[model samples]
Target chain A: MNLVQISLATGFLLILLGLYGALTNRDILRMIVSFTIADTGVNVVLVAVGYLPGREAPILDTIPVAEAASRITDPVPQALVLTAIVIGLGVTALMLAYAYRLFRARGSLDISEFTELKW
Target chain B: MNFTTRKAIPLVLLLLLGSVFYALFAGYTPDETLNRSASYYASQTVQDTGAQNVVTAIIVTYRGLDTLGEVTVLFLTAAIVGLVLAHSKAPKGRSGSGFLPSGELLTTGTRMLVPVILLFGAYVFLNGHLTPGGGFQGGAIVASAMLLMLLSDSAERFSHRLISRIESSAGLTYVILGLLGMLFAGGFLDNRILPLGSFGSILSAGAIPLIYALIGLKVGAEFSSILTSLEATEDSQ
Candidate 1:
């Protein structure tokens, strides 16, 4: 298949791996890393969606005046990826910070020990 | 029965996910822009936003609202983190033993690379609208630089006041600029407030480059502060 298909398959595999890690790994930090892998997969797929096999960057000087729109690659996905990147950064930072706080309070990053919230 | 049920969740999830993927691929029609509009966006970007980058146009103009929402989400996260990690009293000092040295090589390398990393981060942040990198990525890189310092030095306390002031002011400025756009331009967060200079010029794209720069500053400060706060509380506990 094409690169996009390969990326999709890889993203799914990553999600599966991450799911296994999140469920089986006891450490909060490890879980977070797995989640990041999952997120990276999604981001990769999203970026891949906009990938034009042969298209050039949509700069003005590259294409003729009349054919400018037709020759350039789709930029909307890049925009989406930009937003996703920011959101992912914010969320990952928060998650890691929370994990740190948890470590401080309990002296362990093992998530199973955090039963107070569950109860 | 126990073994059967234990296996059911994954089996069911796999089937459901597989079906969904099948349907998605079957129905996955690319946008009309898959055939067109890349160039349209590119040319219009040059003509309207005065930026040569169509990605910048889509980010700063076509999808500016989404960018605003992303910023808001970050603001809310900062507030939540602050609330959760807030301590009424000063941190109690760590009674535990000193940090174990991982390796002299890592420590020295991190010390040497901090300045270069910081410079690269600034460069990326400043040239966001013109380049592949942007505020968020650059800000995070800068934060990583600080993280290395924290991991290696562990003795230098970051200035909370400097970080907080930068964070709050940057967040406030974003909203105020959005309001200014509402007052003067097409709508909220309009990049059209500033003059659209010549295409590919750094001064072009109205307020986009400035906005992204501010975002970079805010994100870098906020992330550094978060790390410092975490380290402080961890040291005390």
Candidate 2:
């Protein structure tokens, strides 16, 4: 209905799509891409949950100090989202490196092809 | 399991999860007013950190240690990626297959754009305490510039020595600044080491800008290192 609800729904949908993709994709790279989509969904949900109906961003440049307490959205979730996004990038990079090594070792990009370690 | 069944299971699960999420989201309502801590941060950010950006203030001042840890995690990930891929030999004859020589237009454009992107990244991190952008955003921008260069010129190599030096010195300075804060200010990673100058100005926010600059440089270097390592493997192919 509102922007927050729309964004929240979109975020959840993205997470579900990402989960499905990650679970079903046979390619390791595709799975990593799905995970990244999930990370983005988590970030979107976080920022959306912290959103107030018509409040401005947590910046005080435009808003006067007297009205700031009532005008700005929550800063904590935004901060957390920022941190999470960076950490997610790092994890993705690590996963990509692992994929590269796996491909180098086995000459295959498919996760199903790398079943030598499977019991 | 059959291929159709395997695909159908995840789709069904996704649909179920999506419905639950939609229900949760549809029923939820955001609070009309700021919560207690949010109110405090909104009111006190200017007085405490002298940062016009409340999000930046919370990130760099109220939760500086968390930021430090995040940077360290990024640094560690870059290092681990390098370590993990160190022994892998790139396959021969694949480089020319997957990559082509850069066009003259791209080469010239990249040469022109690299410096501008680097300067913009510096500006973003430097003005972080006053604006919406910060170290992480700026560093990522810088790394993107490096990525552009790497993509355009397959032969060009980033200097590993320079990257490591920048990373180590920035990290060292960040630690020292945190220690300085602990000794001189209220506690560890406090931003009050220097005078909290004029509010809404670049010079304000005490040590926040400095710390963020260090973080930007460190993060940029780390990302560049990761790119370079990945690029090195590509070159050997």
The TM-score obtained for chain B of candidate 1 when compared with the true chain B: 0.80
TM-score of each model, paired residue for residue? 0.81, 0.93
Q: Which digits, one per residue and each the tens of the lDDT, describe model 1 over residues B44-65?
A: 6666666656676677666777
Query: For every model in order, what is the number of clashing pairs?
Result: 3, 0
| Interface RMSD (one decimal) of model 1 | 3.1
Tens digits of lDDT, candidate 2, A1-119: 88998999889888988998899889999999999999999899999999999899988999999899999999999999999988898899999999988888889998888777888
Off by over 4 Å in 1: A23-28, A58-66, A97-119, B1-4, B26-32, B35-40, B87-113, B154-157, B235-237
Q: Which candidate is the best by lDDT?
A: 2
Tens-place lDDT per residue, model 1, A59-84, is 55546645666676677777887778
lDDT of 1 at A33: 90
What TM-score does prediction 2 earn?
Answer: 0.93
Residue B53 Cα positional deviation in candidate 2, in Å, after optimal superposition: 0.6
Model 2 lDDT tens row, B136-212: 98999999898887778542456678888999999999999889988999988899999998888889889999988
**Which candidate number would show the highest TM-score if scored against the true structure?**
2
